[model samples]
Target: MRKLWLPLLVVVMVWMVAGNGEARLRPDFYGSACSNVEGIVRQAVRRKLNQTVVTIPATLRLFFHDCFVQGCDASVMIASARDDAEKDASDNLSLAGDGFDTVIKAKQAVEAQCPGVVSCADILAIAARDVVVLSGGPNFTVELGRRDGLISRAALVAGRLPGPDFDLDRLVSLFRLNNLTARDMIALSGAHTVGFSHCSRFASRLYSFNSTTAVDPSLNAAYARALMRACPRDVDPTIAVNMDLYTPITFDNVYYKNLLDGEGLFTSDEVLFTDRRSRPTVERFASDQAAFFRAFSAAMVRLGRLGVKTGGQGEIRRDCTALNS
Candidate 1:
């Protein structure tokens, strides 16, 4: 009876946390306060997308980084004079300028119609989905009503994000700590379908990969050669490459197919297919675009719900780059 009681209590706690977040974040959360919220954001996002193709991956990556570090609160948007904000962190420094620009533009447009009624966090969430749809990916409703967090510290970002070299077990454990499962991790990884990674991030896999091999054996021979040409050791390591080689700019299920063909850019990505535990999911998503779309949408919703500060827990920052004074 004692053991059973503990398990039951844990289950109840998990259910309450998940249920409470969903209740607070609704699709029509701004229906009354800001009736044209989605439309305003869509226009702003479209404008940004038109100006630069980087908008698609940058904004999508921004949302992921924001949610992972600060629980979808847009705390990552804060800019500090002392260079100590979350965005100043090494993991976040690579986030492109276009992402910040997209959210800021949307926030400005939102404030024009409904001043102080919308949070930067919600705008970011909406903009993320908008970019995905604009980039030829799945269109899913984004839950709104998340408030911007006041705290943004560079010190808080370490180990919060998944790395390029993480193995399947490490990746699964990291996601699990955030109340996510292996399936969720794999599905979320599909975002790489339209993502980019810098050369330095995966240089080791291409050159000097231990004494056993020159290049990672998991990489397709032809793919490795392509990567080497694109990211020569003597050249700048900051040069960026698309995560999906086939559809470099589009957001689709090609990411999973790349994994099946050993073209996954990062070990963290290819591990999804190499590990027997997660290979089946990788294969399923690779073959069925509809299945991948459904799973991705569901995973994104779950990812957005992590550590959310809804209701009175957080504030609606007037300036996304700084907490309201």
Candidate 2:
């Protein structure tokens, strides 16, 4: 584990120094343009979460989905004429509506105060950070100045985003493409501590995973039985199960602990603990909340930097649900 940490740290440092000539994001991005950008996003997220706790996880997942597909731009919020946008992607259908609604509401609030100044992408980055803090997680500094993407085709989503069934190597390869290390991937996944997964996403484990496998042998028997009740063979696809049954509303290390106990809801998640390369980080995070929070914060900042748009590349979308005209 000690040997691994050095390599991971070097990778992160290299990423920090590398750039592609686009406008770089910074913590003080809106210092002069929209002094209250962070406050506006925080207030809107708090109000939405106050209305429904689900928005915390929803917003977090929303940010992840958006970044993974088309950088940190707000392309995921765009609605297409023929339902061909990123949001319409089959894998994205389960994203909680509350997440989109919260961003829209926050964008509206930002526009009211600093119309046409803050980008929807920046709003999402800030909102994601705020929601985590509001949910009892670490309050890390979030860089801003990301622009909204103009192109959001559903065709680009399939292979770009990691799925709920990926193995360790596949997951590592995916995150590495975005400049994230294996430790970063495990830490970022800790967000599952507060989210909900639809029955359809994990139903295979309860019924039949494949032609030869009836259930995932890694899952705890008692937990599997409970999941079966929550997600029967014929259960509606829309029905959801808390990702972390122990502390679904809190943003702690309980999700990692659950994985340690074979209570991970997704195969993608459990594979982290089972795979030797990532298992140490998973175990460390499960036992040390501070470590998880630190890594998660750093990884999120890295995620926010993935394929960002800036320096006249994109626009400050007036309406998050549609591209700027």
Candidate 3:
């Protein structure tokens, strides 16, 4: 792990230097130009949500995937000709199309009124917040002024996003690269409460965790059986299960409660309680839903500011899926 941090730290230092546009973002950035940008996005999001509940988690996950990459620039939504874009990466291949569709639809509505005044990046930020609110989560203001990124490559995604199996140390180090703290990582993990994960993402916990233990010892025996039933051996890789078995559709601190009961779907998810270091925070969140909401809301605002492109750094992409000609 010492060797891992040394080289990774160098890469992060460079990313920080190149991607620090948070100071340039402001909530009212489009107030003078597209004052109704948030309204337009929220309306589109509500409509989409009515069509399919999947929009809520899909858009939320999309926002995370976008920011964890080169920055929250909507590069993940870019369509590549040769399958080399960020979305084309294996880690991102499972991203539901509804996530991309939400942003594109919102971008279209914004463009109709504001023309080149609004950015796809800003629209995405607003849409992300809209999804959270629509899903019974805390509502928070989203800062705007992000410009669409000019770069989108699969190679840049390696080691950027957190994995399902990362231990506490690995998770902390990876999030720290973006200047986020351990507390922030826990708050973000609350997102799992609302989304779904493919069977392949956590099947290792059931099938072949190690030579000795057939299943992870930390997993509750009943929950492990439930997982195996949903994702039997040789099950279709595309088969997905809700992240939170109790209240999967609602966004809440039940994730922490689930962690406490050893029902967390991923090793990374369950470790919040299994590891003594992060257990207290998990306990606090599980016992106090209000505290979890406050932390999650604040963390999301901070998340939107990561590696944003502002002013001349990026263009107001006329289309969310392609760069301007």
Best by TM-score: 3
For residue 36, model 3's alpha carbon misses the true position, in angstroms, by: 0.6
Question: lDDT of all the models against the reference?
Answer: 0.85, 0.83, 0.85
Candidate 1 displacement at residue 193 in angstroms: 0.7
Better of 1 and 3 by TM-score: 3
Give stretches of model 3 more than 4 Å off: 1-18
Best first by TM-score, ranked: 3, 1, 2
Better of 1 and 2 by TM-score: 1
Instruction: State the TM-score for model 2.
Output: 0.92
The deviation in Å at residue 88 for candidate 2 is 0.7
> Positional deviation of 323 in candidate 1, in angstroms?
0.7
lDDT of 3: 0.85
Instruction: Report model 1's TM-score to 2 decimal places.
Output: 0.93
